[model samples]
Target: MRPQLLALLARAPAYGYELKQGLEQTFGPAYPQPNIGQIYVTLGRLEKGGLIRGQEVAQDGRPDKKVYEITEEGIQELAEWFAAPTEGPRVRDEFFMKLVLAPGTELADQLTLINNQRRHCLTMMRGLNRLAAEEQGNRVSQLLIEGAVLHLQADLDWLERCQEELT
Candidate 1:
């Protein structure tokens, strides 16, 4: 879980559903999306830590909804979280594991997967660049978008290099 929970909460006072939607959409359509149980659990943990204050919102069709607002401590926690270094990223590469375990996984199929990935990365890179272009005068958002684009660009370049090496 990201330590920036409070900062994320501060973006808007939100319920579990809203937070899940925002976080899952943050990186666009590139990766696996987050689930509702995960979001609710995180919110519960944050609430226990006093990082957020919850208010019950009345709903006509159902039970009350719990809305979370960031607290002062949560903001401080976010700052600390931002400053901390993450360990080597946790990767859930079931596909890669299968490739390793199943040595005879056909080379053609593997190549197809790699090619598809490159196409997806290229598409995302193009989209990020287009969005950045639209924010020409907004240096901060443009820079942030450009940074994301660069990450995609680097990955695409690496994939191209790998293909060259393999061939």
Candidate 2:
């Protein structure tokens, strides 16, 4: 969220509301809507960190609004963030933990747990596939769905390996 907001501010100085709208427009529905208070809090932090500076502007009929602009430090931070690779998906999911630990626990059969989780993954994949097909024009959404499908496929494969090992 910090880097994203910095990137937006790097483009132009904008008030908190404008930045919020910019995020919605840029990410579409893929990004969840952030609370206004959250935006203000983030802005405050950025200002305190010297990554951004906020200027209070007096309005004619309303309260003064603080507009934020990215600083050189923010741009450098954004560049460093862009260069860093994102961490891979978690291998030790909660479901996997429960499956491995359920043998001696009061939980039901481990195989049944694996099967139920596999079914849920398949269901999610089907829904994502449907969304991808329906949103052919929305490239961003399609890409996100495709990524989800790939992850689900990997999870299904991992479940098979778990079953083989546990049984």
Best by TM-score: 2
lDDT of 2 at 45: 97
lDDT of 2: 0.87
lDDT of 2 by residue, 1-167 (tens): 89889999989999999999888767555456798899999999999999999999999999998889999999999999999999887877799788878887776788999999999999988877776677777677667777778889999999999899997
Mark the regions of model 2 whose C-alpha exceeds 4 Å error after superposition. 126-136
Q: Write the per-residue lDDT of candidate 1 for residues 1-167, one digit (tens) a residue.
A: 44534666878898888877675556443334568887788888988988888999999999999999998988888888788887753365554454344436555355565687789888888887777666666665666677778877876776677557553
Clashing pairs in model 2, backbone N/Cα/C closer than 3 A: none
Candidate 2, residue 83: Cα displacement in angstroms equals: 1.2
Candidate 1 residue runs with Cα over 4 Å from true position: 1-5, 8-45, 55-76, 87-103
